[model samples]
Target chain A: MKVVVDGMGGDNAPYAIVEGAVQAQKEYGIEIVITGPEDLIQKELDKYDYDKSKISILHASEVIGTNEHPAMAIRRKKDSSINKALNLVKNGEADAIISAGSTGAFLTGATLIIGRIKGVLRPALAPIMPGKNGPFMLIDCGANVDCKPKNLEQFALMGKAYFETVMQVNNPSVGLINIGSEEEKGNELTKEAHKLLKEAPINFAGNVEPRDIPLGNVNVLVCDGFVGNTVLKTIEGVAGNIFSVLKEEIYSSFKTKIGGMLLKSVFSKFKKDYDYKEYGGAGFLGVKSICVKAHGSSDAKALKNAIRQAKVFYDNRVIETITEYIENSIADNDENIKAE
Target chain B: MKVVVDGMGGDNAPYAIVEGAVQAQKEYGIEIVITGPEDLIQKELDKYDYDKSKISILHASEVIGTNEHPAMAIRRKKDSSINKALNLVKNGEADAIISAGSTGAFLTGATLIIGRIKGVLRPALAPIMPGKNGPFMLIDCGANVDCKPKNLEQFALMGKAYFETVMQVNNPSVGLINIGSEEEKGNELTKEAHKLLKEAPINFAGNVEPRDIPLGNVNVLVCDGFVGNTVLKTIEGVAGNIFSVLKEEIYSSFKTKIGGMLLKSVFSKFKKDYDYKEYGGAGFLGVKSICVKAHGSSDAKALKNAIRQAKVFYDNRVIETITEYIENSIADNDENIKAE
Candidate 1:
């Protein structure tokens, strides 16, 4: 299978993106199409030796920066790296697409260009994050801020299908993020969504409190984009604050400095485990084709992993599974409504 | 000034509650009334030697539990320690009330029994939490789950008043907690609330993203109870997970153990600074009288700090100031409606 890569995306740009594309193509045995200015991409690719036939360059003249308006940029920058890469997947020239570019621009381009699955209501940004027990998926991290109950129901189904296929967890348990653990607790959206989730065809673990999210009790956590975004950012904020505090304390005195020196390996390992780069990227689930948005600051290793993630998404037919799930669930709901 | 303490509250009750009361009375020179079974409270109070005239006991046989429904328990358990303590404030027998009991019960009792201030829309739980730079107040942490835009506007006002009077910050900045920083970048509720906040009398700092919360950018962060609760708990969950992971890494090997031992003091100090006990307790804003809800598992030190917070609230006439602010804002809103 062939996967398209945005060669002029992220902080490391052409060098890291080219290297990662080459690494992924060699290791995963997938054809890679890099999109950007041809000369710069070729210069970066020349630094590495790879199978010439497996890696090809598709030159795109323009680039989308993070600061530009997402929808407006996607509409205007037709020749941008992100736009070109998405078009490849849309036209069936590539099986999947990976970009470490502006998340908003990438998501907007993918949805507006490639389109959504037949039965899907909305595409969600599902990020696999490290938890106390293992990793879990937080769906609708920031895709749609204002959501209806139907939207959250779709998020749960999409999150479950994506987690089970990409993460390889069978019949993954899905939990609705709420302020309280009871079914009756939550605002109007979550309260109604909780009922729908209980009736959905997935393992519906009831309401999950925010305090229990880090424990990794469920494989998939579903919520509206507003709440999901807040939770995701709050976790990052708290972790960043704690690490900063720990660093200050460790360097405050001579005794702590020696202690920090001795535990250097331990700290490095812990940081590696919690790093966003290790998780590759967040998948824009419900899109017609596989689309992955890597972190904006991703390095070569992160981009490589993101390509691997895209390969898995394409191979497992995650989009088809989500479509089937949504179609069947919607049919059943229609039948229930008719009966009532 | 006189402060009433719920002697039968919290996990370490009447021992911790009684001791904390005596400590507050001795340190702050405020008259303290401990409400619970007279015999049990007296037994705990006997351990401390202090001014006899400054402390007294109020006999209340029943007790409200954390497991009980907040509103129902408040109505039925009239003689409970929490109920009696709230009544003392309602009747003007006490200047303020401190409870380490069930948060829900205390908040409900305070609002239902003591009543809300004139022109107050709703009472809110405002907690002072440790941030990177200093402490910040998260208003409506878990009071009203489903809130209108007006409720959030009032929360910003009450939060500003509380922070200024008790924390002694002059005209503290109030920020609306949202997924994005832009005024137009939130859900319907936040979008409308943003407009109202900008027009409100408080020092509106526009929208603050969740990622910037721990940086202490705003003195008061306002949101609906559902979002506020989730943000507060997510911070706790992430911090707890990080510390647990760090502990596991530090204990995994012999070298790390030596490092951990040497850094024990630094770790202890960091933990102490981040502890909830250091900040005292959350205040129930908009209540007619001062009402502070200490953490459920509060120790004597925590409870004493809660009493200290109540004393500050009483001395600063926070309720009076909030009432005036709400009344003026409501009048201005009415006038605006008329002009339109």
Candidate 2:
């Protein structure tokens, strides 16, 4: 399978991105197509020799920086690496696409170039949270800010199908994140979404509070973009703060730092468990091609993980399962709507 | 000044609540009125030898537990301790009210009995957040489920006045809590609130993220009740989880437990610094009288802090300052609206 990598994105562009592609080609036995300025990409690739036959170069002259707007770049920058990489996956040149670039840029390109499945509304990006109950999927983490109740119901349906296929959970429970775990807890959108979710022929667990999120009380956590984004960011902020404090404490004194050496291996495992890079990036589920976006600061290791994730998406037949579920669910919804 | 205290509130009520009232009477010299079942309160008080003349009892026959619906109790359970305590403040029989009961019950009573201030569109419950730079006021921590842009603007005005009287920070900087500090980030409400907050008379910083909260980056943090509640709860969850993990590590073995004992004094200081009880209680601003609601599981110490907070609120004339500020700011808004 051919995987297209965006070599002109993220904080550590060209160098780490290109290195990751080289390492993946050697390890995974898959054709790796690096997309960026042909000269710079070739120059980076020359620094390391991998399996020559497993890698190729795709030329994309233009680059989108971190400061550039997503939709603007997608519309205007014709030869941007993001656009080129996504286009390769759409036009049967690549099996899947991966990017460690601007989230907005990658999502914009993925939506416009790759397009969505037939019956899907807005595409949602679900990040698998590394929690105690394996990894729970939180959909619409920040894709659509202004969501109707109908949009949330659709998210739950897609999320359930993804977990069933990729994670292999049998009838995974879907939950709506609310203020409290009661029928009458959330605001207007959540209140209406609760109704739709209950009747959507899924294992709906009603409402789940924020406290239950880290505890991994449910498999698929659903919410509108506003609430979902805040939840994701809060977890990120708290986790980051804790790590920073732990790092300082581990090095504040000679004794603690020495003690840290004794526990270095242990701490490394802990960091690995919480790291988003290990999750193989957040998959854009509703898009036609399996376009996964890694964190902007992804290194070689994270890029490898993102590529591995694409394989899981392909191996588990995620796209075909999601298509079938969406068709049947929409047909039922249409019938129900018409009757009402 | 007369301060009404709920006798039958909290997990350890009557005995602990009576002890707290006795301590407050001796320490703060404020007349304490215990409101609950008169017989139980009298029995608890009879066991304690103090100046009985300084304390009085108000009879309330019914009590609501944590499991009861807040709205149903407010409508049906008329003679509850919370309602009676609030009524005392409403009728001006007491200067303020304190309760460590169910939050929903306390909020219900405060809104229905104690009443909201004049011209206040929505009354927000402001909580004192412990930070490195002291406490910053986070209004709308969990009051309004659905907030418009105007409600956020009101939170800023009330939070500004609160800092003036309580924290005594001159021209405290107000911030709209958003997904990111970047200008174009956050949901629709925050984007709209950004414009209004910038025009506000108080020192207005544009947008602040969740991570910025602990650093005290802004004096006031404003958002809708849903987002605010999630942020607050998430911080609590993270802090609690980390502390527990550390505690287990420190006290895992007998030798480590001995080390913990050796550092017990230092650890106690850390516990006090981290404890929410030391920060007083949450204040129901924009109400007629200052109403401080402690945690439902409050011990004697948290109750004492709430009483202390009430005295400070009375001494600094918090209500008057908030009233004066709101009058001036909204008048400016009225003029701007008329001009347009």
Top candidate on TM-score is 1
Worst 10 residues of 2 chain B by lDDT: B258-267
Candidate 1: pairs in clash? none
Candidate 2 Cα misplacement greater than 4 A, ranges: A246-269, A338-340, B249-273
Compared with the true structure, what per-residue lDDT tens digits does model 1 show for residues B55-91?
9999999999887889999999999999998999889
Model 2 DockQ, alpha carbons vs. true complex? 0.44
Please give, for residues A1-340, the per-residue lDDT of candidate 1 as tens digits. 9999999999999899999999998899999999999999999999999889999999999999987889999999999999999999999999989999888899888889999888787899999998888899999999888788888899999988888888889999999999888777788889999988898898999999999999998999998888899999998888777778889989989999999999999888777767888999999999999899898888999999999999888888898889999899889988999999
How well does each candidate superpose onto the true structure, as a TM-score? 0.95, 0.94
The digit string of per-residue lDDT tens for model 2 on B6-91 reads: 88889989777888888878899889999999999999888877787789999999898877898788778889998888888889
**Candidate number with greatest DockQ:** 1
